[model samples]
Target chain A: MYRALKTKPWISLLAFAAPALVFYVIFLLIPTLGGVYYSFTDWNGLFRSYHFVGFSNYVEAFTEDSRFIYSLFYTLKYVLAIVILQNVIGLGLAVLVESRMRTKALFRTLFFMPNMFSVYISTLMWTFIFSTAFPQLAEKTLLHFLDQPWLGSSSMAFVSILLVSVWQGAGYLMVIYIAALQGVPRDLQEAATIDGATPFRKFLHITLPMIMPAITICAFLTLNGSFKIFEVVYALTGGGPGYSTEVIAFNIYQEGFARDMRYGYATAKAMILFLIILVITVTQVAVLKKKEVEA
Target chain B: MRKRSLIPSSLIVLLLIIVTIFFMFPIVLAVVNSLKSQGEMFKSVIAWPKALQWENYKYVLTEVHILRSLYNTFIITILSIVGIIFCGALAGYKLSRTPGKVSAFIFFLFLSSMLIPFYSIMFSLIQVASGLHIQGSVYRLPLIYIGLGVNFAIFLYHGFVKSIPRELEESAQMDGCGQLKTFTRIIFPLLLPITMTIVILDILWVWNDFMLPLIMITDYKSYTLVLLASTFFSEYSTEWSYILSILVLTSLPVILVYLVFQKYIVQGIADGAIKG
Candidate 1:
């Protein structure tokens, strides 16, 4: 039995890996490769027969398709704002909630309530707040800014989507940051306090570095998540104001399934999105990991 | 010194209270307005309704098949969680135990796709699912979720299995048990903590997932709660009373789960994020 196990260890490994591997390969791996392959074809998603179109689909996305280009930039802009805002707000809330001696759990639960609901549910709730409650509140009071066309107008729609995204997502990162904060030793803070450091100075020199790993994770999450944001945009604005709020994922969804059904072209756009996320994430992690080590 | 610090402490407390209000605004507004009549809501959005509008909730519950949608969501969430945990634990255990070239390669293959965005694969995923005739069926969606979700769960389980001692499993095998039997009896029960983490994360994920069902499920009869609520929103766009009632109903389950499992859910999210 020992000799048999030694001679064919792969048999056991194969047995263990087979179930997951089978499902993964069929649903995830095959479609991924198929997506890459079809990006080079002119398949319109209906007909099985198609011709290889080289890089023309990619070329059109960058050059001729202005909506795709616009959506790319729009998504990038949204991602930048979300990454910065989500992390900063998340860390802020974490620090505040952590510092409190009482009401900490209450605040944490309240903040995290939105995170429990689905993104669409969160957005839908916010939509009513923006469209209905805000207007009424504004009319009753002097808060004129509240009465602006939130999901209807251009600038407000962006603000509305950003608000909802940050509101839903920040609490999640706060939980992460809170975990990291708890991991930081009390001795370090006491040491810093004894060294005549102010609270801000301690947070800057001690607390921040101690929690760099969580920050890195939060940044990575926000970057990856905000880039692929669809449900929020889809549920809230539906890429309205004539696609002003259209992120790359929403644009791809529109091109492939909703509007044109241009599977190959849509695949090309999806590839671009995948590559962007890959490159950006790689650089971000590499840089952040270095910071983590240095700290 | 205490007197001097009081001002700063009060300021911080004030800021926190304001932030809490901001966070709770939507939920409070939704619930409050949901109980108001249409005329009452239009008159004073802030005021409590003079009379409760059970009719709004009644209409949504009875007419829109909200219960059916909730049942569908429950089915999809449970099945996907079961599928992910079972497949992932098996693969993760084996991969971690066996440290050969084949194991490393397969593990690496699973981990490498972690960077591939879901949108990148979504278009082609639809094609593959349709070809397999699993697109419209609610029952089959969990199978696809298992495929998509197993890698992360495997990664989690693989790391977790490391912390568990191997001697227990070996001793179990030394006795009369077969490999699968030993794993089922010895290893899996020991993996309960990580399993809890995985279950919590995936329940939150598969339950809340919108894009997958939106693309895969075309039939109205099979709509998940979120999709159902969303379609209801669009169809009855101006019916705020009905919409708010449905929205409140839709968010109730998750909120209840959160209230019940708040500690574990929070820990599981942090655990999953940090580990992954």
Candidate 2:
């Protein structure tokens, strides 16, 4: 057997890859395939038997389930808000920090510090701020607007979620943008300046295009991340005020584990989510890659 | 023109200062109020405490067994990282060097799964875990992490291995070293840069991940730091002082690690983003 394996290089390759492959197959690959198969059945997670249900799960989720449909739109809104706001603020901070002569490192560290905390922990801290600090501040200071129900109303809850997400996320994109900004050729900026170009013009025409790849990367990161947001909403509002802030992942978690144990139905919803993410991300990457090449 | 430019530049600095304060607000507030008694905190969340409340930290530390949770997190993180590095490095090295459809297909198999979101597989994954009797076991959780993490690690290692010269391995082979020995002695040491990248990134994920531990680990003894802090928060939801202290204690280690390895962490994020 050893001699035969020695003669065949592919067998040795399998040997080398076998350890990782074993774990990956058992834990990840099997789960993924099992998820897809279970999506076509009516397995409620407890029974030893289940029957195939074809596309009923998909049709029901689309045509019948209002909560699931609402979550889909809500998640899309979240994705758009996070992608745009995170990149803009991140790039803005990067440009501003880079302009600092001596305090650049200090600012970078301070900005990225919040991201060091777990999302759960960050949400806890913000909960204190919203529940305790804001009301007290409103009483003490003249800033009456700070007294509003930041996490109570539907609109405010949406805003509050976006606020925390951006606060934790923007700094990461800033690091990427800072790197991209540093990679911008100093000579080109000098040339533009010498030609009497305003700083804004120099940034718009020169810096922006030079950092387009970083923009694409940051956008991709935020888009993928925001679509699957679970912990913040889970901990913060608990999808409060009648599920107004329910993201897709949270809705699926509710279906599969928390509320109903319809593992099959939840798996179907999960597949839909996977397809949406796959399609949107692939399209974004293809379009961004084209732009990156042109730039 | 110089005078006019100075105005906007200074204005930018002023704006930055305000934003920095805003960014630091939650952390500063948490830290400040963590030291106040609940009554003192209620008086004014922003005001200085009249008396220090070290008891909040003491209560969480002793009663809640937060230190044990921290140790549990450390053990799981280190073990999973070692497993990932070992498995990922071997498979990535062999697959990169070997030329064939089989190797390409195996590599593709690993790479394609990176697109599958964790939520997509998590439900069925729980079923698999329970079937294997690994659910709720702290020591066995790293195995699942290794499975989930190795794909990305393999991708990184595959890209990094290309830069290593093949002659190093060939020369080791000629010296009568077996393939495994050659890999361990020659190729493994050279993969340190990418290995560091993987270790840093995985440490953050495993240490901070809340959902997996929440679902898998039913026993409080197996609770990770984040999980314990979360449970503590929900139970003592109204006790701002105790909850704030727990939050601070939980975050202190990560903040310290980030401060000590600031440059490497930043570099790791950039490298992972660019390469990945």
Assess each prediction's global lDDT (C-alpha) against the native: 0.88, 0.89
The DockQ value obtained for model 2 is: 0.59
lDDT of 2 by residue, A159-221 (tens): 999999988888899888988999989878887778888888888899899998888888888
TM-score of each: 0.97, 0.96
> Considering only chain A, what is the TM-score of each predicted structure?
0.96, 0.95
Deviation in Å, model 1, residue A210 alpha carbon: 1.0
Give DockQ per model, in order. 0.64, 0.59
- The reply for model 1, stretches above 4 Å from the true place, is A1-7, B1-7
Estimate, for each residue in A152-236, the C-alpha lDDT of model 1 and write its tens digit: 8888899998899988988999999999989989877777667777778788888789899988888998998899999989888
Chain B only, TM-score of each candidate = 0.95, 0.95
Return the clash pairs for model 1, or none. none
Put down candidate 2 lDDT per residue, B179-250, tens digits, no spaces.
Answer: 888889999999998999899889988999998998899998899999998899889988999999999999
